[model samples]
Target: MAAIYMRMLGYTVTLTMHGFNMFLMNNLLQGPVMEDPNIRTFSAMYKRFFTVWTMFLQIFVASLGLTSDYLTLKYSNKKEPYWLGVMRSMKNRLFAAILWPTVFLVSTFFWSLYHYDRSLIYPLFADKILSSTANHILHTAVVPLVVWELVFQPRSVPKSHAVNVAMLTVYMSTYFFVMYYTYLEKGVWMYSIFGIAYDTNICFPLIISFIGVMLYIYYHMQWFLTQIVWQPQAKIKM
Candidate 1:
């Protein structure tokens, strides 16, 4: 069965270790490879890709998710309205637990698709810089964890769509702000698609609109999958 600690602890440890290994490999063993003369290895190391940011955030939020789930597991089994029970069984707080880790899982899917042809989006240098194990950890392993939550950890849809939308807006806006700031500071886009969009006028607006529509669709889609399809498996049946 999919348990929160099992799901999140695995993600947290695996990702942290992977990142540590990379840090060691890059800094100590061989040193950072400066692919672009314009971009410093230090800036490029921490502030390179959406995938890296997602990995960091997913690990962070999923740790919180684990704590939320632990509280619920410990307290929700009984009738007392413990604080952890609220985090676990409540509609809105539970949604926050589900949504944040999902922000990265969703990005993982897009990253795989975008990297199909490195020349088109990711570029060839990425392959040399990041090992296949690192790539798979970031791109492939995340999908099953997301699916696990959908199948085993379902929760009823939150009462207010506004709250869900606001949560998503704040999270995604933070990512965009980071992306924009990184670009301004380093003269590079985290992903090639963004750089291409920024260069064109019409495409930029269309891209923004497209992302908004996708966010709406994804939120509802997750709700439908959990609330309708997998509701029976939920620990606190709604």
Candidate 2:
């Protein structure tokens, strides 16, 4: 009952955050920024951001958690295990394996680079375009939501770590391909780091390697944290 209520709260929060972000983004798109022809040409790229991708994943996992929890709570004595199993599997595989790592990476990387030099990941001028509230919701609030899910929701290590990592790789590769394609089309890199004048050949590969390492680290971090949460409970039951 407690877990169900907690997840319901999380789902509500995730939905509200996503809704506010969508509202802010819509306003930005339809507002004066679009009046600038140059900005308008690149406005479509906003959807391609990793933060945006993780936000969608967050909402998905939250919904999955809420549904699975609700069913479990309502049908505790019933025998409808199939759908519950499916929902839990999807939530564990997608949320624990992929979403956590990606969200962690985005939040950490964005804020770290943002504070060191905003121009690398996000431009200083973009502050005027994107409100601080929206920016924090995207980059800041996301971390706590993932952490809250990890801490509050009982989770097991994903059944197939390899498959989970493969899906993450595919998602990441698609984004990289998009960035490359955008660069080819517009003659400008989506990120300033890639546009650096020196040693441009090494930039993309280096960044990709770094991201791969970070994601792997965060994946293991999630596993370790899950153990911390569930291991003691398992022992007590035994």
- Residue-level lDDT of model 1, residues 41-146, one tens digit each, is 4344454465666566555545565676665566655765666555544433434433444454456446655657554455665654567766666666655555
Per-candidate clash tally: 0, 0
Q: For candidate 2, write residues 1-238 as lDDT tens digits.
A: 5765876788789888889888877777776667776567557676666677788888888888778878877888888778678877788678756898999898899989888988898975576567888898988898888888777776656545788788888888888888788888877776787777324777767878999899989988987987888754422100
lDDT at 98, model 1? 38
Where's the lowest-lDDT run of ten residues in candidate 1? 91-100
How many clashes in candidate 2? 0
lDDT of each candidate versus the true structure: 0.59, 0.78
Error of 2 at 187 (Å): 2.7
